[model samples]
Target: MSPKNLNVVAVAYDRLSFFEFGIAVEVFGLPRPDINPWYRFATCTAESGPVGTLAGISLQIDRGLKTLDRAGTIIIPGWRNIDERPPERLLRALRRAHDRGARVMSLCSGAFVLAAAGLLDGRAATTHWRYAERLQRDYPDTQVDPKVLYIDGGSILTAAGSAAGIDLCLHLVRRDFGAEIANQVARRLVVPPHRDGGQAQFIDRPVTKCEDTRLTSLLQWLQAHLTAEHSVESMAERTSMSSRTFARRFREQTGTTPAKWLTFER
Candidate 1:
């Protein structure tokens, strides 16, 4: 029930991205004597010793899978490959952690590992947008939400992209401790205290009129009048084009449907 009582372990592996793993270490692994008196950190690996990173760097992980037993919270930073199958032992370990009430999290491509373990089946989860389609194609039973930054399913959690991991981790801190303690952690980490994942990852800037004055003007006008109810027929009238023609042109210029784009801008 207390923040200091948490024992956190970050699962690492060979040929992993140091940055993704760093997020766990930065949030839970590192010593924070100022925040709590009982927070502990450890790195768990399938194999002991140094592991290779994407950038030819190596990280030292002295503890093996045995480290998992002591962890109240277990984080899977990432897996090496999605296509390759995860080891049964690792999957069993994760399932046991879940069964024992240990909180588990997967960051970015780490969702693939959880999927392989069959823990994410029939659950709403997310991974990097680049792999969203593939994840859906591979795991039909799971509801893959490519929109939100992360999904917190009580015991299990998954993050979308790299940076989104920070959001999810901070959210966990807020949930476990409180806004004040989470804010303290955020201030120490120099990150935002809170960010609604529903917020757009990247703001869509209005297109410049120099390239296509007509379409750009139409987009600008639509954005300016988002509060006003506008339909395809209404927009077609304003653009002075047939509804079908306007829809086709909108897709060709923006690579998205008019309705979807409007919702995003709104």
Candidate 2:
């Protein structure tokens, strides 16, 4: 459905996945003046009161299930468990939203929630590769493709994993606003405007290096000068440290090799 009102409401619940939630909040929730008539983002819960994160931290959610009724776009971040079913009322609300022509989306394991709701039956969908088989098995009618970063089935969308959620959200931006506006959002977020949905789920993700003050300072500089050539030796020299030590510390701090980090930074 083409909605002139870009009101996006994300569902938040107990054991809320922080990163996936952040993706929605960052993309839709943030104000983007560059794109006039920006999205109106809010959060809703199945029940009221504070919701806890998977790590047991408390999160205060904004509205209740009724809010889904008003949302032009409804996003389910990451479902906490594939083994357990989402609340029946939540499923009903989703179904109601979809029936009324609201766009519905999921991130990571949140696809399982849609599957449980029977929204994904006979539809192309995806999720974090680790849970792909289970999602397919649980909902035999849905076509689950594990390799892609996300899937766009018009009204229903699903993203593969944490970072992939960003891609999915941007895709929504492109669809709703336009390519130029979406690219502007990507530039502000410091991410690519698009990563094809078929991109591999897992790549060589390097271990994060310790984010000491030195590395923090260095990263800020790297972001400002992505075109500048960088190497272990060059970085080490700049930091006034030996190359070997610099390499080790870099991995510990950034969680990836210097080469990989520089490539992404650029």
Candidate 3:
């Protein structure tokens, strides 16, 4: 059986991160002549000539945004600056490709670009947890979920920062091909075959909101007392409430069941 042919385009921008761009090229743009009989890759810029990478290196791209026309999948490796506006041409190309059923992906803060193009509005999406709140604040129409490593919303996908890009790209390959082919590709690259999207983003600092003062107090108490066997009954007693009332309030305040919350606390 022959492997399916795929034209993967990695869109480059001025001040793009070299490491991020390299991740895309290594997976999509590299010549895999020995392993696959059919996959094509290209690095494209919004314009011709040299573009600077975040690592202070420059690369020459022969193709431009026009290449997206022939691509089966389009990827934005990473955004230059989350606060800055994406070039109008890039946004237009991405929007049009997505409209035509081409799979579109954004890695790291690249989700910002997709959100700017209105591709993520009303769809569940994720970015590096550090920018999740900012993404939500900037794009009120989008549904941002910060907990997961990636979100695959059919034609559109968003991945967290750094290594999670690898996870998302491999996931794409798996979806396009199958587990066996995807695993073979992963073995050649020496990367894991699969990482469930449910994996935690592993933020350096966890955010504790101030809205739930009592809950926060309870949480602190739980953290300080994890050594002791804790239960809903004990938690209710600490707050001077019945177990049923405590469980209900805990769910409402935290948006999770007590069991799941305990897992987090643990």
Candidate 4:
């Protein structure tokens, strides 16, 4: 659990998922001199042999489930089949790692694997929208949210799908490192640093492609002057727009209300 010697193990299985698994590798496996002492990443499988992927690629996984025991964090990429139950030994290994305080995370349909292991029982979790219903149906004890991008249940984290896996992984970095470090990592990946998992996965009315520099600059100013006493009316006046228009545009650009953004930034 030392940040300098972080150990992260990603579980691969028969018919491996390429996207989520690659996200784990990119986010945790790559060496980051910017953040000295990055995670030591390894891959393991439930059984053995080359794991076949949906993309028709074969992943050679030599490590076994026992690797979970030595990891400070365990990440489960998308499972091959939701209905295919994970081995009892694999489930037990995950449970043991959790009992000892190893962080567990799942991406997309991988939540099914965690659910099958009973780790998600009585906890809020989410999977890809397509599989959310099945997850809830199969695991009555787990609360499945079909909307948000990800769910951070402390030791257990679950993400919606593909891209959201990066969100969850960056969230882990933000928790272990900090916003600046996480932001650096995101920049390396050419993605935004801190997308709130609570943000709706989809939005009504297409988002505007053009950013209002006037409004964005105003927001930056507001952050630097939190103690200067500000209001929407004030911001609107500064941007030379009516309060209603400013508020609406701000939401469109930031994917959040101004009030929420200020509260979190402060």
Clashes of each: 0, 12, 0, 0
Candidate 3: list runs displaced more than 4 Å: 1-5, 203-266
Candidate 4 RMSD to the correct structure: 7.0
lDDT of 1: 0.82
Off by over 4 Å in 2: 203-266
Model 1, range 88-134, lDDT digits (tens) per residue? 77888888877877888999989988888888989999888888899
* TM-score against native, each model: 0.77, 0.75, 0.74, 0.76
CA error at residue 251 for candidate 1, angstroms: 14
**Highest TM-score among the candidates is held by which one?**
1
Scored by lDDT, the top model is 2
Error of 4 at 265 (Å): 24
Query: Residue by residue across 85-121, what tens digits does model 4's lDDT show?
Result: 8888888999999998898999999898899889999
Candidates in order have lDDT scores of 0.82, 0.88, 0.83, 0.87
Model 4 lDDT on a 0 to 1 scale: 0.87
Q: In candidate 4, how many clashes are counted?
A: 0
Give candidate 2's TM-score. Answer: 0.75
What lDDT does candidate 1 reach at residue 82?
A: 84
Worst 10 residues of 4 by lDDT: 201-210
